[model samples]
Target chain A: MVENRPVLNVITHLVLILGIVIVALPIWITFVASTHDAVRMTQAPIPMLPGGHFWENFTQTLLGSGLSGTETAPVWRMLLNSLAMALMIALGKIAISLISAFAIVYFKFPFRMMFFWLIFVTLMLPVEVRILPTFEVVADLGMLNSYWGLSIPLIASATATFMFRQVFLTIPDEMLESARIDGAGPLRFFWDILIPLSRTNIAALFVILFIYGWNQYLWPLLITTDTDMTTIVMSIKQMLEAAEQSPQWNIIMMTALLAMLPPVFVVVAMQKLFVQGLTETDK
Target chain B: MLKRVHFPRSVLPYLLVAPQILITLVFFIWPASQAVYQSFLIEDAFGLSTEFVWFENFELLVDDELYLQSFGRTIFFSAAVALLSMSAALVLAGFADRVVRGATTYRTLMIWPYAVAPVLAGALWVFMFNPTLGIFPFLLDMVGIDWNHYLNGTHAMMLVIFAAAWKQIAYNFLFYLAAMQSIPRSLIEAAAIDGAGPVRRFIDHIFPLISPTTFFLLVINAVYAFFDTFGIIHAVTQGGPANSTTILVYKVFNDGFVGLDLGGSAAQSVILMVLVIAMTVVQFRYIERKVEY
Candidate 1:
């Protein structure tokens, strides 16, 4: 850029364009596959171009049973399940993390560091590592096949708590003192002063956590044995497996598109917040 | 780390922190301890008996060929996915950072895949490469290459790897691009003025400046490939065609749920837990060191 080499500039653009193509190709193919009928999808050399049956596939996928022979909830139902789960997880995590972070940063409490370490241990024990026992615990609590089952166990986030803690630490001590001088209680101070100050962090973390909750697969797949409780993300596997027998590529790909739409929309529409939350939380 | 003007010790803070501690205790710590305890016990196939056989399960895992092969395969898969996705992202980020215009446009296009569920990503790629009706195999037929991932181990591994890496590229790209953008422009301009070409500047100045990010991303990507790609592998191959694509996580799930090998699976889970703990420690240490830089 400094030397203004036209060839280098063109090369950069070309390479970027190629990168975009590679990144977008599978999705493009998915879109193309979704636009066709079931019959056309079974043939060799599936359509690269979009077919005219997009609405037909969309309607059938969203309204009708997702895959025949498989006892899946309707696509719309699964979408609703995904939405509910995502919102619950995002809100639940933000709520618990906010209060805990408030406790850690603003209030002196017994066993605070122990509690922090407890939450820290959760970071190392992803559900994947504690699969069978965690399933047993959830089952023992009679929470399986429910929203609580879907979201509660996954809601304790060390990173979000830590992020909020970091945000609160950077706040001036004067704010707390001023709140205390104004006779604000600890809860009142947190609800008004601290919450308002960390609004952006909360919103950004929501964006990231929503995508995370929406995309959850193994946990939901394990807990929700009830077909009606199936999340859209977890249903994709059923469709994929059912496709082996029935070869409903059109319907399967349409379900795939619908499952992906909300989170992808969140990422693209909330790009700035998404980027902020990602770099901040993961780092 | 508490604020200087913190509230006095009170039950209010206990109330505030109780929910997280409760959930962590019930869900994480309890289950983790259960796994550790179960790892020391061998359950009968009919669940009629469980014997406390400390170190026997671990010993079995050590001597088990399938477990060892799975261990090796997991390392290979993690390395392959991390290397492929990170290098691709680094190259794309390098080029994306060079763009004078529409960089945001390029980035927006690139990063939305990060929001796609790993299973959905796998489904998309598996569909694209679905042996019979898939367009890729159709094209490959012209070049006389057979491409059935369902039956072929190597093809299945390649399929899962591609799917895993494809889903990860968006994340790695986002991080790499952010890292590159954070490098001081003055350093780059100075390198350019000193007669270094763009590549030379990148190699000499830009890349070195971003090595911290590279290290950070390496840990992240490794963790991702280890734990997060379960959905991808599950949806795409189910560790199929004779357990070809079965990484450690998949094997744990399969062994516990499907194979009903509770003790073996619990042992694997404990090992994975230790692995995650080690990785988390490494990450925190690296981050601490990174702050000094």
Candidate 2:
């Protein structure tokens, strides 16, 4: 709104349009590729526009085995696996983090700071750094090839707990005193007062964690040997490898689109919460 | 840090924190200690035995040319990704801030890519540049530039950097835009009244105000390029052609999981842990400083 000369305004719009195009070109190409036939996709200078085979590609990718040569799970099965994993991680992390945050903030227990530091240490050791031993631990527990195997290890982090802890610290002490005067026990206070108060924070964290769980690649790649346990995000790698020989660009791109759709949908649908969660957690 | 009106000390607190503690001990603490321990013990190829060889793995890592090269390459990769994405996001965010209409629409279009997983980002980029069949290669041929990332090491690095940066632009843009919008409008308007143009105003006033956001994003993007781009590298080049694209994290996975060099891989993991710890300390320190601001 400050001194908007005509030339400056035009340049602003042009730059923004260019940025949008640069940002969107990859997805557009992926979509166009997904809509074409496999044979058409294999040819050079692939169609810039979407083809008539959108329904065919969607059904074939989602319903049938992804690539004919590949021994991968059905796309729907992988999507279901992804959904299960995302839901488990989001819900599990929220549940444990809420309770632990409540305990740390609202109870003067022994070793409270010790527990806080212990949880804080997880922030430094991302799973990538300790992949091997972590895999061994998970394998030893016989959690491999299962939903628990997919999610529980990843959930053992402090980001959500820290976020919830921060949120709890901001609540007025008067609320707790009032709740106690009303004879609300610890669990009752947490369930009735704390949970509703942090509703937006919970929703925001869930959005971030859901996308995170859905997009997990390396851990799932390591643990899920069985095709039935494969998630859609992990399946894209398999499909890409398959494409090297078969060159099923249409189906491969279709699978890629499907793998990303759920998380991307969540982000776009809950843009406000996603942004809040991202900014809050990182801080 | 406890509340003034906290619940009385009881076993209930233990019950409340038990699940998080249990998972943390089993998964995070135990495995991390195992990584540290395994780093000191050299395991034979067949898993038949492990001999305690304190400091040998670290020594080897220090002397190993490939490991040293990967360390350098990782730094280079992180720096390049950070610079490329941050600058692009800064420009886009700056312009987005100036636009009077459709800013939200542009923001929505710009930020959805943040949800795209690194692996999927890699897949999308790799498809567009797949040498023989890729659209980019076809276009590059018009310019007489060969575009085979499969064979060219530099091209492979460029491909990975681009893919990583492309995914990160959305994140940086959002942060930069938010920071830019938070600047007092009067400052820019005052500069405008003083006959400074938009670009001049940004450089003189707005940019300095958002340096904190810039610094925070530098660390965030560096950590991201360090850890999160594993998927992108795995999908795009698999550290390929001649190990040109192998960053430290990828090397750790390849050596441990595929080559089965348990001791050395564990040592690499330990080194990465130290780096992450250092970075986390720096980030937290900066955040503390930011709070003062």
Candidate 3:
């Protein structure tokens, strides 16, 4: 913008427009396909515009048994399961990480650094790398096919702990000194001062972690065997498989839309926090 | 790293850390150790018995062509995804950085895709490229190009790569745009005064300045493609078309959970853990350097 060259500005706009289109085409196609009837969706060169069957498709996908042949849970049940899993993971990680970070930052205790390093090591052991043994552990604990199974094993987050630790370190030492002078115990200090201070950080992290928890695939896929326990994210795979025979593109795409809507809405609605959370946590 | 003025030392800290420590022990450390232990012991198919055969699984994997190819494929996939997504993001970010008006609008339009799950990304792309009914194939057919990921190995890889890259563009765009915007405006203005065009200034000045962000994103995207794209591959191809798209993570899951090759899968897990550790070390090193800068 130093020197506005007319041609360059035009080109920039064109390029950005093109980039947005290409980036958004898949979602657009999914939306258009969802709006159509099953008969029209199966035909070659499916309708590129909205169809009249949008309500029918949404109601059918949400309430009707998925794909007719597959023994899947109702869409509402799966969405509830996904919501439950996401909330548990986000809240659990924030709670434990805040306390652990508080302890590490505010206390001088034995094996404190050792404890920090233990949490740090979890960064290297993503679930994909240790699929078998983690599965065995979950199975042995009889956690399979439960909400706890879906959420808790994934709740211990090194990144969240580290981010909170960083946040705690930035708070001036005088706050704690004054709180101590006012006869506040450690828990009171944490609840009153630290929690309020890090509220935005917690909200930001919640935005990121909620999407993360909602989008979990491999863990939930492995642990959840019951139909009612299926997450909407995981059920898309089942619907895709079922589509080989049924080709219920309208219902399938509607389900896909529902599967992605919550996280996408969270991101768009709280984009500032989402971006802040992403950069901070990843760093 | 402790504060100068802190609470008195007591058993309270232990209680504070106990929940995280317990979860880490039960889920993270114990399973990781089991993976290492089981890697050395070959288990019978029926869970009857296991014989301690140290390094045999590793040795077999080293000699196994399929495992080796999967390792290579994983590297290639990671590189391609990083390149494709990064370049696209770079271009879009560069332009977005230029336009002052509607910058946030452009950003909002661009970044929401980051929220889409990998599995949903796969589902969306797979639907678009569905050979019989999809719009992409229909369009590609007009160009006289066949597109069937079901039977075509190359097409399957392309499909997953596209889906993975598509989902990742939003993340890379945000980072790249942030990095680019943080560059001092005076520098670009000075370059323009010196008769450097936008493209030349971009290549000569802006690009070099953001190299740290580039390096940081490269590692992040590499790690992401390695681990996070499991859902995409699972939903889209299932590592199929004769296992052409089977990366290391997929192969581990396939061999362990589906095929039930316990020792081999454990060995694979151990190797993957090593890879992750190495990547994490590199990323941390870069982050440390970024801090210094």
Best by lDDT: 3
Instruction: Estimate candidate 1's alpha-carbon lDDT, on a 0 to 1 scale.
Output: 0.91
Model 3 spans > 4 angstroms off: B291-293
Q: What is the TM-score of each candidate against the true structure?
A: 0.99, 0.99, 0.99
Tens-digit per-residue lDDT, A203-262, candidate 2: 999999999999999999999999999999998888888878889999999999998899
Candidate-wise lDDT, in order: 0.91, 0.93, 0.94
TM-score of 2: 0.99
Full candidate order by DockQ, most accurate first:
3, 1, 2
DockQ of each: 0.90, 0.88, 0.91
Docking class of 1: high
> Which regions of candidate 1 fall more than 4 Å away from where they truly are?
B291-293
- Note each model's CA RMSD in angstroms: 1.0, 0.9, 0.9
List clashing residue pairs in candidate 2.
none
Fnat for each model: 0.95, 0.88, 0.91
* lDDT agreement of model 3 with the native: 0.94
lDDT of 2 by residue, B161-267 (tens): 99999999999999999999988888789899999988898899888989999999999999999999999999989998799999999999999999989999999
DockQ, candidate no. 2: 0.88
